[model samples]
Target: MKICVVGGGLSGLVSALELAGTHQVDLFERKPVPGGCLGSYRIGDYWIEEYYHHCFAGDAALLDLFDALQVADRLVWLRGSTGYYVDGTIHPLTTPTEILRYPHLTLMEKARLGLLTLRSRRFDVQALDGITAKDFILDNLGSGVYSSFFEPLLKSKFGDRAGEVSAAWLISRIAIRSDRGAGGERLGYLKGGFRHFVARLEEEATRRGASIVPDTPVEEIRREGDGWVVDGKSYDAVVSTLPPQVTADLAGLDIARIPYQAPPA
Candidate 1:
């Protein structure tokens, strides 16, 4: 089978590498380089991530992928601190003592917040799907804690439209968080930068007989007799991993029902 993969982000690159040996793979990337969000730019002396990302211990798939690429040894675990800016003060919020001493909430409110956090860690996210996060917090922790603490945090993180966020996101966040180790929290980063991993993936794909074309965008996609045509080039199968809006335009599909929010950059 001949497969044409559009986009060269992490997902597209991984998919291409996985299929290169079994099929004739052609990867088309509109950008000059791969890595997508994981891509980095050179700073004064070191490369920096364009966006913030920290891997949790439970990210087994990502860890395994890094190991398979022979870059596992480069992964580093770092402990960091967190602060809460409340009532004209930046309070350290890393430990239980800090939580208890937080002046933004009363003692009862703090206890309620603690219980809510514990419950959030254990609760099944699927069961809370139909409920919004704001509603769930208010119901479980009372309006006081919700309004005084979590609400402002959510707004700062997700913008003014934070109420539209799904409870499932919060549930997953808490669940992953509850698994953190005793020495504060640990996050992984590559030794040099993620570009090393990206280079390895591209090399492996090419060595396995895959063709990668950068700066080539698929302007259109249409169904032919049995395969699909991408900008008039025919292929047995087409895998599009672009944004939904771009995918809709390329496939000539309606975009009326899809709802998406842009993440803060």
Candidate 2:
């Protein structure tokens, strides 16, 4: 089988690696490099990630991949702090004492927020698909918590579309970071940069017979009788790791709108 994997981010690279041994695979990347969002920049003698990237203790798949690449030993656990800035003051909210000192929420409101955080892991996130994050926070945690706490965080990430973001996204995000201690959440990072991970993935996939085409953005995809045509090349199947709207645009298909926000400047 011949497979066309679009967007040589981690997902596309890993997919090609998984399929290359048994099938002819071609992975396309728009950038000169294959890391996609995980791409890094050269700083004198070192590579630094374009964005701050970290993992959780619960990231099993990522851990397994690190093990497979013989780099699991590079995983480092660190305590990360959280905070809020209001007016001109920076309020650190990592520890219980810090949270208690926050001026915006009442003691009762803080208790309610704590309770919700404790119970967030048990939430049926799928049931929240239809509800907005704004509504979810307002209903369960009260308007004070929503406005004083979560709204700013949401707005920071999603901008004007924050209100339209789903409760499932909010709940699942909370659940994943529920492993917290007095200092902060336990987060993982590679000893060096994640560029090593990307390099290993690309090397292994190519060794297994995958052809990686960098500096190539998929321009067109269309059905041709039984199989598919991607960029005028015939393939038994096409797998796109690009965003849904982008894939829909290239494939010329209609899909329900899914809101996305670009990275903060």
Candidate 3:
């Protein structure tokens, strides 16, 4: 079988490698290099990410993939700090002690907040989908707790749309973090940048008879008979991993309704 994979991001690269064992694979990437968001740029003598990214210990899928690729040794975990700025002051807010010491909430409010965290961890997020985080926090910890602490945090993170965020998202986020082990609470980083992992994937795919073409963007995709043609080139199968707008344009399909939001950083 012959397979054509569009985009050379992490998903596409991994897909090509997984399929190369029994199928001839061709990967196309518009950028000059692979890695997509995982790619980095130079900052003086060091490399810096365009956006902040760190992996939690519970990311077993990523850890397993790295281990299978023989690059697990490159991962390094670090104990980092988290701070909150409230009322024009920066407060250390990492541990339970710090949370208790937080001056923004009263002792009863703090206890209620802690109980809410524990309950959120144990509750099913889907059950809370109909609620908003603001309402849920206010209901559990009171309006004062919401207005004094969580509201500001949400505003700082999500800006004007903070109130629109669903309670399920908040619950899931807290639940996942609360379940992490001591080491899992820490963050992990790949040495030399994530490009190393991307390069390794590309090398493995090519070694397994996959052809990777960079700087080749697919302008069109149309179904013909039982196969697909991408940019006028025929392929037995096409797997598109482009943005929804790009996919619609390539396939010449009507644009579907999509929720619009501020561009993520």
**Candidate 2: residue pairs that collide:** none
Off by over 4 Å in 1: 43-46, 254-256, 263-265
Q: Give the TM-score of candidate 1.
A: 0.89
Give the winner by TM-score: 1 or 2.
2
Report the candidate with higher lDDT, 2 versus 3. Answer: 2
lDDT digits (tens) for residues 1-265 of candidate 1: 9899998888888999999999999999887877677776777877776677667788899898888888888888877567888668899877677767888789998987777667776787888887888998888778888887778878988787789777888777877775544455566777887777888888888889889998887899888999988888889998888778878889887866445655433
Candidate 3's error at 151, in angstroms?
3.6
Candidate 2 lDDT tens digits, 52-143: 99999878898999999888887889888888888998899887778889998999999998898899999999999999999998998889
RMSD of each: 2.3, 1.6, 3.1
lDDT of 3 by residue, 1-265 (tens): 7788999988889889989989988999988877677766677866666556667777898888889888889899877677778668998777777778888779999888778777876787888888989998888779988898778878887889899888998887886666433332577888876766778999999999999999888787898899888787788998777676777878887778343353342
Which structure is stronger by lDDT: 1 or 2?
Answer: 2
Q: 156, model 3: CA deviation in Å?
A: 4.0
TM-score of each: 0.89, 0.95, 0.83
Question: Model 3 off-target regions past 4 Å?
Answer: 43-47, 127-131, 179-184, 254-256, 260-265
Against the true structure, candidate 2 reaches a TM-score of 0.95
Best by TM-score: 2
